[model samples]
Target chain A: DVKVTQSSRYLVKRTGEKVFLECVQDMDHENMFWYRQDPGLGLRLIYFSYDVKMKEKGDIPEGYSVSREKKERFSLILESASTNQTSMYLCASSSTPVTNYGYTFGSGTRLTVV
Target chain B: EDQVTQSPEALRLQEGESSSLNCSYTVSGLRGLFWYRQDPGKGPEFLFTLYSAGEEKEKERLKATLTKKESFLHITAPKPEDSATYLCAVHSFSGGYNKLIFGAGTRLAVHP
Candidate 1:
């Protein structure tokens, strides 16, 4: 089974704090995605990378940015975390096109901004 | 607009009760539709993928059927272990790549 590992299970950050959520996939998949899941709004894409050093903005990428310095690792960065930014962050990895096979997701990181 | 919507925000069922969850979508293009199971506080676990209408896929006690505009996940003789949030997503072209859109999800509670 492909394993996607998230660095944090829970995180609490003060408003305006900079936060980082890390994800690493062992399957050597070329695609990685960052999503924030919230109540009522469902899951919204924040960022995605198809290859090392390549990134694209998703639907809701205003408060977040992503880095893919290595093929196996992708990181989600919150430049200035806000109370409204508190949500469950999910990391997923896949091969080329997501349609070939669905993404394999990590356990998720729940971040609360106070 | 490309969108995905799920019906019945929440559901409660007794053991052995059977029911179906509905996922409806409208998109510029329909590459695929996927079903996932998510436990509380966890990310979604992929279940099945349907590409075309009149397609069907089955697992232990769950069956997924897709149509042009909607999909159905039928749970038969469900047990308490089947309790979880079932999520539906659609893949479409956007932002120079295929974008995945997810529904708010249906929360299921199966009591023994």
Candidate 2:
């Protein structure tokens, strides 16, 4: 079975603090993604990494950045955390895009900014 | 622009009742349509992937069918444990890196 693990399950940060959310996949997938889930807005993609050292912006990438220094790990960075950024963060990984298989997601991290 | 829409934002059913959830999509080219189940405060768990319009897949009491413009997930004789938010996503070939456009999801509640 594929496993996608997130470092923190719940987090709280100040208004201007820097936050990091880490994700690691054991399936050796080539694609990793970060998404934020809000009450009415489903899952909004923040950033994605296609390969090591490669990154791309998604629908809502503002105020966020990503790091993929290795194949198994992907990190989401909040430049300056704000109350608006407080939400559930999810990480997912897939082998490739050419197949019909969907991504395997982590448990998710609920972040609260005060 | 690619879009995915799910209907009947919420549904409530008796323990043995059966129903279907709808997911409609519009995209340049379809790569895959996916069905997922999400419990409260957890990430989505993948259920099914439909590749073509006529394709259908099933697992236990859940069945998923796809058409040209939409997909349907049917639940049969559902139990209380079957209650969860069911999400639909479409991967378009026109986009880069196989990005998926997801629907807001339909929350299902089954009461005994």
Candidate 3:
């Protein structure tokens, strides 16, 4: 089975602190994405990388940034965490073209900004 | 604009009772529609993908059918283990490289 592994399951950070969430996929997928899931709005994309060192801002990328240094690892960074940034962060990777394959998501990281 | 909507924010059923969930979408050019089951505190698990209207797929006790305007996930004789939030998302040719548009999702609870 394909696996997307997230570094942390839960984290608490002080407001304005720098934070990092990591994701690594074992399937050698080419596309990786970062999304934040909230109660009413569902999952909204933050950033995505289609290849190493390549990134695109998703619908909601205001407070987040991403790094794809290697094919297997994608990381999401919060420049300065805020209370509004507290939410469940999800990482996903897809190997096939967007039209043909759905994403394989990690277990998720629940981040709380105080 | 590309958008997706799911009806019945929540549903509760007794064991052996069956029900259906709905997902509605509107996009410029539909590429695919996907169904996923998410357990609490866990990432979503892929269930099925429906590419075109009239397409259907099934697994265990779950069946997903898609139409041009919407899709339905029918749960047959559901069990307690089937309780989870069902999400629907759409991938379309809007910006050419746009990400999938997701709905709010239907939270289903099955009682034994």
> Which sections of candidate 1 miss by over 4 Å?
none
Ranking by lDDT: 1, 2, 3
Over 4 Å off, model 3: none
Q: Candidate 1 on A1-114: residue-level lDDT in tens?
A: 899999999999999999999999999999999999998778999999999999999999998889999999999999999999999999999987684557889999999999
Give the candidate number with the greatest lDDT. 1
**DockQ for every prediction shown:** 0.76, 0.71, 0.72
DockQ of 3: 0.72
Over the full model, what C-alpha lDDT does candidate 2 score relative to the true structure? 0.92
As a whole number from 0 to 100, the lDDT of residue B76 in candidate 1 is 100
Candidate 2 runs further than 4 Å off: none
Each candidate: chain B TM-score? 0.98, 0.96, 0.96
Cα distance off (Å), candidate 2, residue A1 = 1.1
Per-prediction fnat: 0.66, 0.64, 0.64
Between candidates 1 and 2, name the one with more favorable lDDT: 1
List, residue by residue over B1-112, the lDDT tens digit for candidate 2: 8899998899999999999999999988898899999999899999999989999999999999999999999999999999999999998755455788789999999999
> By TM-score, how accurate is candidate 3?
0.97
The TM-score leader among the candidates is: 1
1 versus 3: better lDDT goes to = 1
